[model samples]
Target: MPDDDYDDDRDDETRRPARRRRGPRNNTDVPCPECGARSVRPGPWPWYLGTIGAMVCRAVICEECGHEYDERKPHAHLPTRKRNLAIVINLLGFVGIVSVFVLLGVWIYFTMGRR
Candidate 1:
């Protein structure tokens, strides 16, 4: 590629800065843990997965107090519960199926050889 074609200044205008959303932010006015002030701002989003669900939340930090809090705490226990139930039900079904086969083999062994 040509050197002039890859100019930094030309790409500067094309790359727009990320715009911060305007809204009634939750936990924004919460007091910081470090400074005990309400000058907290939204920080980067934290990604985590738990037994209940996957969690992704923007971190809030107090500018004056230096406290941090999570903004998103989506509950995912319903899906987790359903998944556990499905696994248990499937395991029971497999056990029942294997028992049926075993019973049939025993019955055949007792009846077929005598005849």
Candidate 2:
């Protein structure tokens, strides 16, 4: 019985500590547009034509003020200048991708289709 008690104490000393529970990783570092608290988290998915359409928009909510906004447009209500710039950048990227495809097609037509 004394040996069993000693073994139990040794086991407790060797046991690993419980890990700290981490919050959701999505948008956690972003500051809230309303209160500026860095506790933003991805909100519940929007219900449109059910779950299929919910994937279209990503809503981020502030834990401090309970303010929710689109992830792409991080401002409180309307889009900010930074948001507009992001939109322009995304559009330029899309245009560049399309132009690449068009150039590839033209090259293929001239090289293979002509022969």
Candidate 3:
């Protein structure tokens, strides 16, 4: 029972930071409203997109019947089709600009030789 016999290791110990654990908020096991089959998938975006938008929009789709739904309030659907159309239009615009520059370069190249 001597004070010197106890090592002061308790005071030297560093405090560990508290770890924040995330828990699942919704029950994913719930049956699909459209189809009673458990083949329904949960998450945002379609299954083809790998469900990346699950964080922004909690969406669900029933594979058995091709039914789509969102459980989260104020849910937003992905504008994939619109985005694709925009991309195509932008690409065409870019090609047109480049084509114009190429045409101008060719015109100058030929005209300068004559001058």
TM per candidate comes to 0.34, 0.36, 0.33
Please list the residue runs of candidate 1 whose C-alpha ends up more than 4 Å from where it truly belongs after superposition. 1-76
**What global local distance difference test value does model 2 have?**
0.65
Q: What ordering of candidates by TM-score runs from best to worst?
A: 2, 1, 3
Model 2 poorest 10 in a row by lDDT? 46-55
Off by over 4 Å in 3: 1-78
Clashing pairs in 1: 40-62
Worst window of 10 by summed lDDT in candidate 1: 46-55
Model 3 TM-score on a 0 to 1 scale: 0.33
Give one digit per residue, the lDDT tens place, for model 3 in 54-110: 443456666667666554531334364434544665677799999999999999999
Model 1 agreement with the true structure over 1-115: per-residue lDDT tens digits: 5777777667886897878876533445445455555555765432222322223333565566454554342123334544554566567779999999999999999999896
Best-performing candidate as measured by TM-score: 2
For model 2, how does the per-residue alpha-carbon lDDT over 1-115 read when each residue is reduced to its tens digit?
9999999999998896978998644445556667777667667652322442234345677777888766655664533433554566567779999999999999988999765
